[model samples]
Target: MNGESAMPPLPEIGDLAARQLVEGTLAPIVVLDADLCHLYVNPAWGKVSGLPASAFLGRTLGEVLPDLQRPDDVLRDVLRDGQPREATISGTTGVCSPLGQRLWRAVYHRVELPGQGTCLCGIGVEISSLRRYLDDLETAHQRLALLDAAATRVGTTLDIETTCQELVDLLAPSLTDLAAVAIVEEEFTGAPPPPPGFLRLRKTRGVAPPGMEWLLRQLGGPGPYVDVPRGIATRHCLDTGRPWLGNLASDELFQKVTVDPERTRLFRAAGVHSLLIAPLITPSRPVGVILLGRAGASQPFNDDDLVTIQALADRAALSIDSARRYSYEHTMALELQRALLSEPRTPHPAVEVAARYLPSGRSVLVGGDWYDSIPLPDSHTLLVMGDVMGHGFQAAVAMSQYRSLLRTIAASGAGVDKILGEFDRQVAQLGLDRLATCLLAVMDPGAGTCTAASAGHLPPARVRPDSDVEVLWLPAGPPIGTGLGGYESLTVRMDPGTTLLLYTDGLVERRDTDIDTSVQALETLSLPADGPLDDMLDTLLARLANGAYEDDVAILAARQRDAHD
Candidate 1:
């Protein structure tokens, strides 16, 4: 006792001090016995749990608050193990004012009371507002990411149907349970219409119930048109250029949007709980509408969802409009090309003739490729094949001018060389800046001879009655409109049962093969010895033009008959 200094006895706390400290502190404090029966609770506990002290005292934790039973079990474990623990629990309060839900961080400890034996003490701090703020921030980031992805995925090409499909795929299974795109029929025809016009279902991406599936199939995959009747929510949205959000709680609401009774029944049977209809609008007018729906298992669409979907629809509208304009222009260009290249004149009865024209498939613009046959005065025929250097309206116009001038000069009885010279001079004098390749042949069946000329064009191929194929060797000249003015002609003997083929480069040229290889391939091509001229031409095109080409093609075939026949 003398060697070891005794520690000073700890000072005892009064009941008044302990009571003041527990009641004045802001943190929620509660005391429960080992049996999970609440012995005491501070005022702060009442403020957070929305319960008074009277409600908590002298009652088992499960009997007073059922939602907190899980957290109370943790305190019971602490009492048994004599070890303290800390955890966060989330639950709704009994008396809700403005806070709908709450989270709490509670620290549980086993303590020994002066008169009540062993007990569990819990102190909790509220963290609901901070948790809510974080959740909101996360949702904002997700919306931003979705918008960015939509911008990248939509409008990859100038194809209306493809763009519509892309938009539908993006919204389904991510934003809604079902997604569909409907476009105006007038929009496809390139016609302007008043508001609330008919819409055609273009594409869909989701599975519906049996009833809704039957209705969708009846509307046609991409054909049938449905009118947006007055008083319907979709029509109102289109007329006002706004989005419509509704809860499909009753058949009456579904019937208001759908004109057919069967459709109304089908929609209600599908168990759709929420609907969003957004108008596909541009600065000029509304093009169509996009419909999205959620079934019973999914959450209803809110204001945020409506705003996001409307923005997506706006982007898709601009893409579709651009594609429609391109389609209109393509149709016009095709018609113009067809009108310019009328059927070739029937050559003399002694010669059999056939021709074909094929435009490039990679783009909408038409190219400058033409073929013609003019009957000369002396039982002869003049065959012409040419290709302009570029595509589009300008190339087509240049092609027409070249063909017209060539016919005018040839009709005056000009020879092959003179015709090429005159056409070159006229093209330069007229200030036509485009370049072209041309091959001209004058067949004189009466004289048993043929005269041919080249202007940077490929040589013609000849097939004899014995199935012998050969490419005529001639001096190549510069392309027309170059103003160089150097052209030449070759004369070859024409025999009975001999066929000649003249074509543009597109027939033989390919991106993966060289020009020389393609020319050789064409020169060695086999043809039936006794086939008709039309049959031979069809066979050649079918064999060569099996896939998409980078340029336009024009081919003319002429066959000479026996004198006796």
Candidate 2:
């Protein structure tokens, strides 16, 4: 903006002194004529370029370093305007470095010598190493971002197939053009690796661009893929516990393993040029393989990519193993509950018994809650519902013991209050530590009445034939195993066709809400009184729970039929 110089120009120096100073500096200096052809070069230029000064003199950059990009226009502008240009960056090729190239940041200015007119002088220094370090930092940042995504994206559900799907969804189009996760069939997580011949894999999920769909189809689609023996790429990943990267065109092991005709044709047709495979190994053993493929014009898989791919795969593998263990425990707990909850036996044709056990959609849903129907003396039917405190295998086992004891005690035709009092003493004597809530009622057909009692349990609802539903006023006692039994019973005469509903607290309890509020809410709802016993119970659950329950539910509904009907 100003015509005046920012500072005074350097004092004039002798020609010999200027030449010596230029030659002695480590920076490479070169002078070019107005035509941009090299006019002179210092000795430092020879050492930097690994060529004599004559190689640059009198020649254009195109003639000397044809592969390197030259900023000819910038130099011409400097020679015309007499202004200085500083820190112009460029890359040079065919240099004497190990990489056969170097990066340079240079300064250019217009200069006049005695015999020559105005020309451009450039002073440059190599910056290839610094540029490489910066590039490495950027690459590392991108890799960290990907790994961070894998933590949240993978294994949000505790299911084996779902975990497999999450892994492929995270990798495809990011690490490769195509990706798939194949789990070894029958190879449970945390188990030892199976023998090679028995290694058959089932592909759980494959992801790719829509255009690449045909490629996945041609490669036998999802499987039960053909059994891969020891030399195959997937087999290599399993055997070595390391990633395998290969080019389909020239990798010897890959070609030998995929010698079949259909695969060979598919790879060629799909333009799939490269592949990277990593084993999904948990701490115990290899569970599956991550298949990443690059097709058509995509860069081939390299070792640097292997590190990121394997890290993501490892994260997914650990989560999958955790899910598998949880599923196993859930199944075991549910099986134990099922064995204890066989169909309730109706004492006589006069009474109808309908029960439902709805476990919530979680691993803990298998624990605690249970119901049963037992026959008593004098053709009476005993209805029961209970929930052991806490959840899991231990709670399930405790519940089974409680249900078994109740069945044995009810056989003696004891009244509900006396039976519960006996239950408290027996469980306390048995050293059952977990508290349990229970409701027991006996429907006496001959007497036309239902008598019930509770042990820290919810009240039973009586749905009259006219649709008048009310939770009976049953006295409460400490939960079983409290050993402070002060039990009481309430009897209500039931008209024929009236239904009695018994349930566990899971049917109404919710977080942050008063238990009485939830119970009163249930009482306000209109029940399907005239419908079949099963339909009425279903309607009750649909209206009350509505898929929002976090705990298991056990409900039993009983109605006494008219003697003729």
Candidate 3:
């Protein structure tokens, strides 16, 4: 501020050249003395930091940048140690022009003036763009992880409630801020209408003041009513399957629909300026919107933020679509599979029955494997386990038809062999050769006898209550629908405490592994020969599926109830 030109403008080299290079590059430039005072700042500094050159001149770093509020210790360390400090410092020290105040990663460089009496020089670079990209990558990776986990978790659960609960749990950590997933029941015609149960925030994150629910209800308007003002983001998301962004004050669309003055007050109180919403569009129609609110002095959502959040929402939409489809198909398959499974045949006068079925892993197919235990009018019981070829809706359909046919045949007073023959003939007649295979058995509780017939299905294993495993080797006839000639059935006497294990090939046939080997492996597991049929079957499945089952299975276990015990 004093002697002009006495501080000779040296050759455009050394410190001068460096300053010229920084100034010409369009980045803010600052020269710091050893005491951290602002010796010189380029014109670009005023544009970026929003501080006029006259006000910034000759001022101490702390005095000129009071908004930064950087701790005195940090400055002392930088000055005393003569080391350049570079970090993404937040808070007031991070303040910039009104436009650049959102988020920024700053890079600081320090170089010592060797012969210039221990003075130091420093510079800063803005890296907010780079940080944004990295954030986007991380968000995408997390969304994919959620999708994979949902698929696995949903596959194992039989009930929709459990599946949805598991899905919410999986999404919690990533979308921790998600308010809730309300099941919206809406009928969409040509007109766009609010979903029934309009805006029920089922789950809330973060803090909640008293009457938060009431507030959200007031904001959303009374349910079953018409004329709700849609936010800019909401309208855009609905009209086009894309996201919408409007800066806080400039979003005129939002003002048009805000009916509640209290809601507006609350938004302003929370400093919420901008809104971004993504609709959960399924293949059928738009379901709901995932809304995000950003409140501050910062500008509204930008192109990059819109694209990034929309990308995340798109993945969520796909996942939601997949989950809905999987759930619907799974429910249908389960109901059909349940129907194919005949009610349990009482093992004795005082018998109890319980059973469990598991389908294949998370694939597009719902397998054709099934089981049944039907009470016969003749006082005997019919136990059957069968696996039709292939896996999927078609396979399941074929299995259902065959199961119905088998039931009818068994009910007609025919022997197991006669029923199996009829089943094969029917399948062949229907041209379902590639879609059928089955085993049928008639158990006489009074005689303690089992007459079994198979069309290339797994043999029933008879386990002796006294630790001896009777591996039955009844020869299997050609699989049903193969047009094989009629076959004879095998009849064997069952001891009072004997256990009969009926299972689909999926239980013993693993990819790249021999069926006999897997069967043997199952036999080796220590399963009690005389127990509750359900318990025995459970142990069998647990032992067989040592890790994971690549195919679906149906298991039926029949054991004489111990009269004395």
Candidate 4:
């Protein structure tokens, strides 16, 4: 009856104490005995795995789970080495229960229980929500990269077809592991309110199969397929103006609505698990859609992937829109300049006039350089070439204005110097902010007379009908508003069958090189007067434009034929 006997030797509950500590105190409690029986499981484990305590208790671990017996398995090492193992379990689906599905993230630990020897325990945590959060973060990062690339590509190029192709190029490699782009018109029905649809397979990455056109044609009507109801990313994008993904294998909306089961099956056979479709949306509506596919045993793409693709599609749309605008403005600028550059009524019947404009190779900006051969009423011709400061629309506007002013002065029969004086006054009074260089030449047919003036502009080159090239570098004056002086005329005689070449400075100026060198180069490259006027001009341009000029060049070449020749 000593103190130990009075306390009944503490009941030898060391093992029970350890088990209680695991079951009640740990975050996700699990207990197992030497015989591989699960003796206890806590609420956290049941909540995570959606399994009850009864599911784990009194069961042989190996009999319940086959992965445990494999030597290379993660759990087996923890048991043999008596070490706690941490690993992410892949290829396991979430557990479904009445209350809702919960995903299990399992952690297995090996423990030694006194008298019970070695045991294996597992603690599970619910991480379904966390997994979704991480997925979202990944998707956002991808979207940002796509947008940045799209913006860079679109901002630099202005050719619509090339820009469109670039967009497809960007998408092809990322989505389908190949480059492909297609453009198609949206279909509209007049009667019976049929489902909306769009064109397909206007273009593709690589060569499309033979029946692609026919297949696309057949896609409009009812058919079993995983595409949106309207058969286009355009339709959905137009309707929603938001990014969307159609999961072929799992989406009930797709399954219920699709008509072409064979096409769906064919896609699956080709290893395309799903389609991530993004709309090429202009602000008005969706013009096209870029379709991306995960093919060849690749896991189906997730929402994040769809988002990135959507961002790229947006940039493609914007680029196309901008290119169209710029092209329209350019055409209009050319047309306006042409309207101002009307041909004068030719007095001499044998004289033929021709001109050409060559764009600079390095810049997309259109220039204000222009040429006009205005036939005077007095059996003569007024040949003019001028270049306004800057290029593009503004220069074009100035060129149009100058053309009007020159025509007005020529109609009044003023001398070249007097006409230039009037222009200087008009330019300064209008405060136009634009400066220009101009050269004007008036030739009398019967008189064999030529009088030319320069306003800081390149002088014309004379080619005798017999094909002798002579560059005329007359005394130059200050530019139109140079404040130093107005222009003066220089006189020359034009023998019968004379040819005069008036050109903008851009025709003779080369970057980082002397004007004389460029002029000499031009002289060396001029074509003989044998072909048609258009052909001769083309040859001259081909020779001059070697992909180096930074400004537009305008040329007006006049050849006055002899009375008999």
Candidate 5:
């Protein structure tokens, strides 16, 4: 022991001046003996515990204040070893204060008095306010982190439903036990805003833990639209462009805000005690609202929580709006692509034709890929497949230009090589900004020969009646709009029922792998045996362009009448 003699002793307990010093101090002070029984306590202790000092003097710590949380073992050791110790302690001891809970940094020192044995003197400084400040600071940090997460994870696609699901997924299992996203439905549909009253909300997404989905859905989670009245929380969030939070179990505002009592009953039945409805609104317009809920005993949403959700909602709203616009444009592009590559008419009836156009999957921009079949007076059918190198609405418009130019030039009875030669000249003369790849095949059923030419495009495939597939290699000149023409034509004899498959590069050109490899893979495909040309096209797409293509695919399949059928 380091100089037990050097340690100062406490004054005699009966000394009036020593008692006055202890009583005058604001800090709670207590003295306990070797048996851990309170030998003395100050007036400050009485003020905090709401009891007289006499109540604790002769009592053990647990017997007098069992609710107080402290390091009991450390206190006992300090008394036993005559050493000093420090600990943090806190509790709500049924005493009223600003915060029902109280906290303290307590120091315990072993004091020895003359003739009297050693006792532990414990002094506690309240630190409840500082602890609360740090707690609030940490909560704020978490909220900003939540917002950053929402910004990164939401709006990952151009799909409206997908964006809604992203928001719901981010909210649930983090800020809420159950969550849903609703939309105004017509906000992106060009419909005018509805008049004030009850508004029908389209459920975009509803999510909860695996087993709780059904319960959430019963509370207007997802699927069929929910019609909300003027005073309803959802409507309040939407109309006012603000959040509406409530305690469904007891909040009187629920009754005051709702025109229908069934809404309140629905919440009660769903066992949702706390609910927060936040608006998903953009500067341009209000998109919709989101609902966050907590079940029994879960922490209710607070002002800080509400602020965090609103920030998340603002981000989600912008993402949803962007996705909606992209979706509309993507749909329009697909429709236009389909229309341009519509079913090729049966050229001269002696030739069968089937064409298909598939836009790049999940791409917001449209591509210019087209196919056509034109009958000439010389009893030949001109089959065309072309691709514009870039993607956007402008590319689709340029593709129409190329398609129309091919038909107009083919009507003059130009050869396959001449048609491409002229196509290049006009594209350059017209100053079309996009470069293009074109493949032209002229089929003569009487001669049983197919003359094909290419302008910087992949070669065509010939599937013989015996199921042998060959890649027809022709001289590929510069792409159109390059103004460099070195076109060449190759004629291959077609046996009866032979199919010439002309397609854009998207059908074969994949990401990462070599172009020649994808082309070689296409030549080895086993087409459906003894079926219509349409089935052959379907088989080709299924085998070659398995899933979403990185680019648009245009396919034109043609064959002269088979003799066996």
Candidate 6:
């Protein structure tokens, strides 16, 4: 057909000639009369649709294959406008041999018959296999992206709960409608599981649909531990160390895992149709179980999904195991440090004292900050504050050793400088590798005097009744274990109502600020004029290192007593 006038129709051929052309072509072809009724379908059309041409001929396109109505409408438009059109339409067609589905790209043209007014002709190619391949490729790419993201999104910290939360957040609203992680209580405390009465499961993290969170909470809230019952899916997974895939459609199987009738009812009310519980297994043992569910119209868990979830569970198990080990070591070190840093000796009634030792926050390992008070022979008192260079068990051990040696040397009648010098020599002689900072103060109430020395430590603060707080300016010395023994002492009058404060750098050190600035801030603190020594120390600590301080802190404050009191 020519473009001009939009009505120059084709030179119609005889039925034999049309049949010969259509039968020879591999692509399916169909012809329709002006009324849009199928007049002919060739052998190729019969092969593609799996229907004999007799079944299609003389029938309206919609009546023969309703799924093709939209494409047929496009052909009608081409016939009405006297134009040629090419288009692709995709959907299930019952006319196929297996009666499943097929995607097709077709070209339609308007033509005139010798006797009839006009007709529509179509040639289509099946693209079902190619479309399926493309869809599968896209799905594979998405799965790869998810696995790649899990590497960074999960296990970002050495905290078990935080890691579990990360895993749930990554999976929910993406992989499944509901996701949760349940770790054994024994994993946290490093203790054996109690009897069934105390067999607890800690739901560390979870996510669910809006308004469905209550159902998850009913199962078990995220923070607190809950008792594991006889036949719960979590219990089975943990005991067997194998994944449990459940089709919630089966009432028996669903009831077997739900432990309670109420929970079963809730599960059905929430429209949960499928579930998967994967054990978080490590090389040593199973640490926990990851529970995933699909609700409403969400797709059921398949073999591919099972493989992916197991991979995620493996990664989470490793991180949780590492955190558990670290927690055990941290607890041991903290206990040892606390034991070594027992309440300082109350040397004499003439000198009232108050001290505090706080371990670092969870993000930091326990360190070697310690304080002590040793009574000398003649009512004199020796006070010490020290911090080892590193953190964790090694530093704690070093701190305990240093504290014992210092007390031993001070009790032998050595002066403050000699005590520090000897401590340094002994630290080197013992081949102890870690360095430590220390400050020592010798107070004699009868003499009304105090002498202090330092080993690469911050200067102590002195508060007098009539004067502003002052930072004692002692000569800075190298840290112990250096064997560079030039320790010096500074003597200052110790009048009644005067308070001496000795503390570790943690009390006035922040990574974001300079050490001098933090020290100056501490030195400028205001103390209550008539407050008790403990009250005054508490106030100073509140001002300097609030509870959120990053590192461990140790402070010792001593106030000289009035002769009348």
CA-lDDT, candidates in order: 0.77, 0.79, 0.60, 0.62, 0.80, 0.79
Residue 424 CA displacement from its true place in model 4, Å: 5.2
Residue range 462-481, candidate 2, lDDT tens digits:
99887778889689999999
lDDT for each residue of candidate 1 in 327-373, tens digit (9 for 90 to 100): 77777877888898888889997777888887787777777898899
Instruction: Give the better candidate number (5 or 6) by TM-score.
Output: 5
lDDT of 2: 0.79
Error of 6 at 284 (Å): 1.4
Instruction: RMSD for all candidates, in order, please.
Output: 7.6, 6.8, 8.2, 8.9, 5.5, 6.1
lDDT tens digits, residues 1-565, model 3?
A: 1111111233333476664575565565565555666656666555555656666656775686665534345545666765666544333333343333333343334455534344434445555556556776886676666656555653244433444355445443344222223223333345466554233222211222233434344445554233333443444465467765545654354554344544666555555566555565666666445555554544566675565555555545555555556667776777776665545555445233455678876564676877777777656777878787888777877777777777787777788777888778777788774656677777786777888887787787877877466666676788888766476788899888787778777677888888887776655666776567777777777767745567787777777666675
Give the TM-scores of the predictions, in the order they appear.
0.75, 0.76, 0.62, 0.60, 0.82, 0.78
Candidate 3, superposed: residue stretches over 4 Å from native? 1-275, 282-284, 294-303, 340-356, 362-370, 374-378, 391-401, 408-415, 418-435, 464-470, 486-493, 528-531, 546-549
Off by more than 4 A, model 1:
1-15, 32-39, 53-64, 67-84, 97-99, 112-119, 187-215, 218-223, 343-364, 373-383, 408-422, 425-433, 441-452, 458-474, 482-565
Comparison by lDDT, 2 against 4, better one: 2
Best by TM-score: 5
lDDT of 6: 0.79
Clashes of each: 0, 0, 4, 8, 0, 0
The collision pairs in model 1 are none
Query: If candidate 1 were superposed on the true structure by all CA atoms, what would the RMSD be?
Result: 7.6
Between candidates 1 and 4, the TM-score winner: 1
